[model samples]
Target: MKLYTYFRSSAAYRVRIALNLKGLSYDAIPVHLTRTGGEHRQEGYTAINPAALVPALVDETRVLTQSMAIIEYLDETHPEPALLPGSALDRARIRAIAQAIACDIHPINNLRVLQYLGRELGASEEQKNAWYRHWVELGLQAVEAMLADDARTGAFCHGDTPTLADCCLVPQVFNARRFNCRMEAFPTINRIVDRCEAMEPFRLAAPSNQADAE
Candidate 1:
């Protein structure tokens, strides 16, 4: 197995955490997202993933794109340490939390979107960063409510054991810290992220720990 990844990408970070949690070993192929003109846009990489996204997983038979899909695939194929374990309702809740971060929060603050804000919309660096912080703060506030109001949120996002939601939450929190977003408002999020970072899988998957990190 091999993973095409960018060190700072939160989406790729999600896949890395999931792989580590499953105890799956794979080669990490660093794809520079902003060297020259972005390696992911190059023909070679695009041939592998037409969407030109990071965290594309190539197993023996197929190549998978999208972090959440790849994570579910891993969980399905190697079911021992299930990423989304429990009843159907429990699973749905876990997925909802994960998507709250992965879908609603992440896409708006992604690298390409920020670049578009600066290059196309003529936004200054300050403006672009403000845009990033706004969405993150708003989204995390909602996540804080979701986690704090629910009894299901435990050591991790879903329960005592880390689940799919924890995998998604840790990376988003990392990005929030990177952008200097105010985190004190979300005490529950900070507590959950602290617990996750203490675990080996999350520690090893952190952007700073990756081989491609600057």
Candidate 2:
């Protein structure tokens, strides 16, 4: 497997964590998202992934795009350490938690959106960061409620083992901290992230630990 990734990309970070958790080794093909006016926008990478996104996984001839879809593919292919293991309802809950971050929170605060805000919209750095913090804080607040109120929430998001939700949660939290998003209100999230960071899989997948990390 070859993973075309950007070191600091949270979406890529999520896939990295999923790969590590599944004990699947893959060659990391660094695609610099910002260098030389963004390598992902170049013809070479766009050919690999027409979406011009990072973390496109190539397993044999199959090319997978989108972090969540790639992760579910990994889970299905390597079922031992299942990232979405459970009954139908359980799986649904896990997917919901994952979507809360990936779909709800992350889209609005993605790097591309921030770049557009500043470059095209003439937003100041402070304004852009404030926009990030506002959405992250609000989104995480709902996630906190979801975890705290649920009886099924365990050491990880869904159970004692790390699942798809945990994979999604850790990277979002990492980005949240990078942007100085105050996390004091989300004790459940902080606790879950702390537990995940202590594990080697999550630690190895961190942005700072990646080969192309600056």
Candidate 3:
């Protein structure tokens, strides 16, 4: 397997963690997202993923896009150390936690979105950062609530083992700290992130640990 990745991309970071957690050794095919006006926009990469996103995976005949979809594919292909937990309800709760970050929080603060807000809309640096903090604060508060209410949450998001929810959570928290989002209100989130980042997979998969980190 080969992964086309950008060093600081949280989405790419998530995939990297998943790959490491599953003990899957894959080649890192770096795609500089911001060099020469985004290499991901180039025709060569657009051919791989028309969405122009980082962390596209090439597994033999199949090429996959979207971090969550790629992760699910990884989980399916390598079932040991499952990324999800038992029971349908538990699975749904875990997914809900994941989506709260992936969909509600991540999209608004994604690189492309922030670039558009600043370059086209004339949003100042402070305003841009405020935009990032706003959504993260709201989203993580809800995640804290979810964690507090759930009996399923253990050392990780869903159980003693890291699940898909923890995979999503760790990356988002990484982003939150990068942008310096207010995290004091979400103690559960902070605790989980601290624990997750201690693991070899999560530590090595961090944005700063990536080859192209600047």
Residues 1-214 of candidate 2: C-alpha lDDT, one tens digit per residue? 9999999999999999999999999999999998999999999999999999888999999999999999999998999798998899999999999999999999999889999999999999999999999999999999999999999999999989999999999999999999999999999999999999999999999999999999
Q: What is candidate 2's TM-score against the reference?
A: 0.99
Task: List where candidate 3 sits over 4 angstroms from the true fold.
Answer: none
RMSD of 3: 0.9
**Tens digits of per-residue lDDT for model 1, 59-130:** 996999999999999999999698899999999999999999999899999989999999899999999989
Residue pairs in steric clash, candidate 1? none
Question: RMSD in angstroms, all models?
Answer: 0.7, 0.6, 0.9
In model 2, what is the error at residue 96, expressed in angstroms?
Answer: 0.2
Clashing pairs in 3: none
Query: lDDT values of the candidates?
Result: 0.94, 0.96, 0.90
- Candidate 3 per-residue lDDT over residues 1-214, each given as its tens digit: 9999998888998899999999999999889988999999999999999999998999997899999989989999899788876888888887888888899999988999999999999999999999999999999999999997778778888888888888899989988988898989988888888999999999989888877889
Instruction: Give stretches of model 1 more than 4 Å off.
Output: none
**Which residue window of length 10 is worst by lDDT in model 1?**
153-162
Q: List the pairs of residues colliding in candidate 2.
A: none
How far residue 190's Cα lies from its native spot in candidate 2, in Å, is 0.3
